[model samples]
Target: MQTGYADHLNLLCDMGELISVLRDSDDIHMFLDQTVALVARHLKAQVCSIYLYDESAERLVLRATMGLRAEAVGVVSMAAGEGLVGRVFDSLQPLCTGECRIHPDYLYFSEAGEDQLLSFLAVPIHRGAVRIGVLVVQHEQADSFGDMDVRALRATASQLGSALENARLLLSLGGGAEGSAGLFQARTPSLSLVRGKAASPGCAMGPALILGMHRCDILRDEAEPERSGGMACFHAALDKTLAELNALQERFARRLPESASLIFTAHFMMLKDPSFRRRIEEKINLGLSPMAAVRAAAGHYIAIFASSSHAYIREKVSDIEDLACRLLRNLKPGEGKDAEGVKNGGIALAGELFPSDVLKLVSEDVTGIVLVSGGLTSHVAILCRSLQIPLVIVEESGVLRIPEGTPLLVDGAAGNLYVRPDDSIREPFVRTQAAWSAAESFTGTMSESTWSRDGGRVRLFANINLLSEVPLAIRSRAEGIGLYRSEFPFLIRSAFPTETEQYQVYRRLFAAMPDRVVTIRTLDAGGEKVLSHVDSAGESNPELGLRSIRFSLLHRDVFEAQIRAILRAAEGSVCPRIMFPMISSLDEFREARSIVYDCMTALEKEGISYHSAPQIGMMVELPAALELIEDFAEEADFFSIGTNDLVQYMLAVDRSNPRVAHYYQPWHPSVLRALARIGKAGRAAGVDVSVCGEMAHEPALIPFLLGVGIRTLSLDPQFMPAVQQQIQTMDLREAEEHARELLGMSSIASVASYIGVEKRA
Candidate 1:
């Protein structure tokens, strides 16, 4: 039994080397030939053959062999369940027999020269649920294989699955065995161009800094170390990681959105969570070293979260990984890597970067990022945009194969990436880079208010995410603060911020825009903007479940605290408005408004100076609210069109889902009608109506919005110059006529076609 364990350890060590070889191998066919020969030698088997499933043909074709006739490698094939090898593939299980000739599923291939084999052992190779191929060995002597041999071959087959899958993907991308070297290692590789979504718009040229390659190493469940004080070492590291997270959060608090900076808050919460701690402690009790225990516990969560279909849940995988890395770094301080020294002024190439990793990479002064795989709505992309880092996300694996320090030019606006671009490509971007820099400075060219060519005026307000954005809004000459997402403070805190704590934040926002109207939206938590302390984690359909105003109402104590803070903060401010989000019914609106009034009355009774009658508003996000716009216009002081959710709910499409992202059309006739209806109703009722969603900043949609009588447009401060320019070029009368024409269109395609022609005209 002791010798069996020794043999297994030796087998694992040998297999690890083989896995490394497969990763670095340029020619997959050559690697397979070497794999067969080496496995035959290791197992002392006469025959070692590899059969790869041809997906298109639905047959298992012999790909490599060590002891069979070499010419029969590609010639021998069989359907699943047609032979011993086929039966293994069909069952997805290992098969071992002393006599294979008389087996029920046996079929002979004369060219293979395998008739002499009396003993057989075959194992299926797969990646996840995907069937890749089969691995088999045979001996002329009966009963030559045992359970140990079956386990050994099974382990080898498992390692081959991933390498074979990568090869298959490469072949599908036109990288055949002969062309693999040219595609990856040539002076000017033909397959070096990659197109992806432009998460942040800008140009950057630099070498590639590959990240996340050693991610699997973090998940390895190694045995206990031969050292005392393992538990003490782990506690020290955990404490140090917490301190680092807090420091980083505070350091970048002024530069990033509270939500973005507080990304580390999730790490802190995970550390404090009993389950995470318990899991680690349990592993340690079971004789794992503290370092190994931490990894094992983290790996459990990472695997579960990464397998989720929901993008939000999957994104948590990165957070957990970042935390694990931080803990590991603290455990072994000298092992810490300095990104600045290794790849400063380079573009980071990663599978996916968590938000914390984004901050780290940016601090190292990396020029930009190329994500070989990631979602569009990843917080990493958001951080890149906020930090003004150029970012492009591609679906290609070839980007990962680029040699370290290879120059890459990223055209983030066009979503184009050129590997090792020549001077011709660099010259245009270099010339434009200076101009782009100058353009972003925005030297007060536009006036405070935007007016069309025909002199119809529109009020352009800034949607402020944090107090840091105030200077930018003031610089852009925004008319007012149309929307201030009030959830940021709540999102970043481990516990809910107290009323006074909330007041201080609100006071800064109100003071920043002293003369302009500041519309503060109440806690819009849940949905995608989840609160860290909330109990909404297990909700299967969170988007449609308790969220937004529902979350605020369900926890009235929390809602009342926020409202009281807003009232207290509004003291001495010229115009402060409070808005409620996701109001589906009049009762929901009435109930929320009653809570605000209740808070105001409580402040009055307590002799606390407060803004008694700040303008109360409702966000027009739900389809039900759209239908009842007239009723809402009468009760609500203003209507802020939250078109992001409006379009999503109206079309029944999750905007973040790439599969249905195209279907989430704000230009849909139904959405246009809804916007028009709300605009007309607000006008009829003498109430202010503004659009504060992504549609507001989109220059092309400005005319349609203006013609629909949406006089107030709220958008990100960065878009002010372009939006001002677009408005200045438009004639309001022409815009009105265009809006009329658009309303008559029944389909999104027609609206698009009409707009295309109108632009040309």
Candidate 2:
């Protein structure tokens, strides 16, 4: 309506020209140059550079630079925490540093002539929580950019990400060797692959499906639920929900897995959790959709239960949240259907599916089905794999954009997926499967420590959670249980499990591991581990909020229960080592150890059977914890570095955050440096440092970790055989040399490229 406002609108529309130029470009290189030229002039910046994470190099490779030397492009790679660029990678937050050198975090790379320095701004280009690349601009003049500049840069960054993904896809389609950038790195695994029970079953064909899932935006920009005003309406919705409760539950039952169904009863109690009800009232008062209101309420419920610092409370809400996610995912599909062009023989892909959707497609004439969802243990995954369907969940974003049928392949054992695969790819899998079977047959009844030609050994272990998991773990022939998370069974139960009940469960677990050294982890809750009983206080960010040891300290009784239960389960046998979670401070670990001592003392007073001395440890998952490694290495008996949380906390990039998850590189130099530092510290202190994080499952990283002085590796049973086999063939001396070389590198991408193994056979 305003005259000058129209001109401003026109200036914005003029950006369409730059967008057109970017669209025409086929690779990330050309697009960056044009983007810098197009936006720098508008933003009043003298220099604009685009840095992308080189997956292989593990570094932020400068792809295109303006007002800099031509040789500088592609030659420079910054560590994830190198400079302003590195800090942006580390934090996943946009920054506008006025005096670049003055910033403590800044690491200057020298090549960009000093004249082009001063004010700096950078925004991460992310596909969900993963930061794929970064867009940065600097000017000779200080104080050059304000909020508007950052906003424009962010908007541009998003477009750049999409463009980069598209270009990579195009390259893949064109059969370019550079196309590997879009695919997850695969190793030419030399390890004897072990077989495990397929949990979520599904058969798929078309593309190896991976969903482009961003982190759930738990932090919505909407008003906080507690401040909303429509409670009476919420009550009415609650009443209506009750009227259809039976039918709703039946539908929900149809929508969830039987394992998940065990927690259905909690859905009822969840609707009753005072916190849950309060969230509903808050949302209803706000006049939001009852479902939206419910979800917001559930988010709050999940947040509290998730951070209860108590495993029992955390487990109590797992299924309830699952049911809610099922409900939410179901409702969302009906909102809009953005169907793309389906290839002649392409199949539909989705992540873990709602049971209703499963039934609908059970008999459909789909070329093949690819689920973007479904964990290995989920019913759908089991069913599909049993059917030998070419489905691949966790395939990154394969399911999202896997164009109809151009040809694809999935080698699940190796976690390799190929899109538009050559027809010949299948032949190798058939052969690999046979080789896997032979390896199994040859190694069956095998009882030998995994050892290399030079006599070096790599310990192989299994991950266990419940008594029900014993059979699976034992069947995997794992020598010992690497991680026994005591939260799952407790979470699924209706009420607090009694001490005897806990003993029975633990007894069953240990009984299965007669000769194995089982390392038991105390309840790891917080950020989704919602305990059903205790009310976990809400914090700004649950991931960084009260969790693990932080929660244990705040909830001493809960911690005592777990400690006593473990002692009781030991029943005087040499108990496995017990490790506390998220120990960032020495006092927290000390308090936890004191509490464990208190539990032991209580047992002693009762004259109950228990190990007189059991190994006690803490997870080095926090940076502050890393800072005190020498102190803890001396105090604690052993250390199990939770690489996932460690990397997340160290880098300040929550892997779950969708917007910046791409930037989460386990091999990032800073993370590697920290890992290497701890690995060395643990080795020097004679501490057994074993990693049970998802990264442990990556065979490529195993050697890297080991070379950094991590001899003990605890991983999932299925992956252990292959990793074990690889270790047997590897020269520890060489591996350590490679790791040392990588440690000296500047970027995670480069380290990954250099250290990550490939499957050539």
Candidate 3:
């Protein structure tokens, strides 16, 4: 093994020990003191201290120390951002430097007796995204800390933050006047407010429907207990939980975007980790019930993750908590369910929810969802958006303290949840909801022909993934179906949907649209959406690998079945159009087209009464597709710009990855230029061009699309009215001028400013 790899493994082992110490300790002061001492020993540093932020005072007080004078522990305090230690907490990043005493930002505290220290390292300790404290280590020698040493210190700080928060919570509960009884009493005001990321956009006012909480009672002592039976029970519950997770993963993979299904995969991996399983087994052997063992083990990891400063790592706590709950409930069935008094139409409140839990809320017809723990990109959040249900993630612990059935108002657009909102606040939200409903009704009545103020006409189409959405498309009066994702039926089914089954589905979709054009993109499944029956090793980076047209061509039987079905569906009245997705090169598109031709010939030989060959097109999603647009325009019947993937590929950013999602800009000058190039190519070849990505729904981008000469747009049915409103208000000439100016802009901020300035005018 490489020396660096060995060193990393050793560091991880040490971190595990540090975590054990934090989890086992109960006293806050002793825990803090031991943490500083252990950190000083681990790094071979001369001094280590922990400074916790006092929110009320707006300063960091020295809570624990190893090398400082004993008297300085409680007395030493610095204003936030005033000293080296404070700066770490304020910036939420680590700082390491030699000759720290000479730095411009250094502030020496005489009482701490640290004048001799030359090298210093400080890392912020946080609970998830919230800053809590700073962990500092100092050395008498210059340049004492290396990169590895800094990393070790940071990991220790994360554990310390979580442990401290847990200790504080216990302290509050134990020290209160009413002791444990005080825990149930609401600490938050009657009119409380909390903010979270807006997973979906809408507004609703209803009573809070709190979900049932899971609890496990640990039996600490039982002499001569049945250890083997407890272990057996624990393992059985673990197996069941894993099975449930696998099923949930598959369900989410079918119903939601590929990114949304990853949480379950992560949970599955966590469950399989030997160390985690061992921890639960150890607890089981200690005479605890099977459910208690699972809860205890989960809590240990949850506390460690909950204290982390990194949002990504901290988010894992929720997943772990959910898994623990599932294990407990599996061990004792019918334990976790909705509270008895929960009524329909109320906003659902929960500490966390799995994808299945959210589906239950949908069945109950809940008006909104407020989760105390969940990320904006979680599967449940995605499901809520698809169901068009408002969801808000409340981060404050006080949210749990709010009484069940409390009148709550959820502002999903603003990411705010109000507890017992007054008449003044509720009145405006009611009006807003009414306005939205009226807008939807008015948009449904809009004419099928969409025209700009300057008489430039654009065909508004609907993007549908399922047959259920066809009615909404019809109601919106869309001229045609722009992009009908044909992968949904395949994804949702347990096995490959038979050729007859696919034909029937296509027949239904074609019949629904009738004479209106229906562009069905051939099964674009691969990458994140893998078939269970396919024998394939998953790609390291699936996005750029075997997907879309490539997958269809490789799996010829599947491709042939879909093509035959599409052709048969077009027999009499339906004018079906077939579009191939993720086509980067002309050869790939040609190969896919040849398969369709082969299918048509086979249908003719079989005496199948199939209609004429449909208009074949390619989805312009890759940067390579844009470059070869003119070449493709020669043979292709039409080109639909999938701005979602195109922008991501052009910018080299994964939109689903939170770290770089901000860089996935549709307004980027390069993306605009590419779109314009495709538009020119399509117009020159007399091929119809359209955009069917989320960009089509954005009203701000409608003018730009018109300016780029795109004459057709396919989007969600709900967005048609607003986009039509924006289009009707626009003058084609002014839009072209604005588009030209926007293309000249260098940055996203500049383009946004230009648009904002124009909107005000």
Per-model tally of clashing residue pairs: 0, 75, 1
**In model 1, where is the ten-residue run with the lowest total lDDT?**
181-190
The digit string of per-residue lDDT tens for model 3 on 214-309 reads 211221122323334477677787787777666655554444432233435556777889999999888877877676676678778876975654
User: Against the hidden true structure, what lDDT does model 1 obtain?
Assistant: 0.78
Strongest candidate by TM-score: 1
Question: Which candidate order results from sorting by lDDT in descending order?
Answer: 1, 3, 2
lDDT of 1 by residue, 226-315 (tens): 333467878887888888778667666655545433466668889999999889888878887777787888889987976665645655
lDDT of 3: 0.74
Models 1 onward score TM values of 0.67, 0.50, 0.61
Q: Which regions in candidate 1 have their CA more than 4 angstroms from the true location?
A: 1-191, 195-203, 215-243, 257-261, 266-324, 337-343, 372-398, 410-417, 423-438, 487-504, 526-543, 605-609, 648-673, 730-734, 737-754, 757-761
Clashes of 1: 0
Q: lDDT for each of the candidates?
A: 0.78, 0.62, 0.74
The model with the greater TM-score, 2 or 3, is 3
Which of the numbered candidates is closest to the native, going by highest lDDT? 1
Cα error, candidate 3, residue 650 (Å) = 1.6
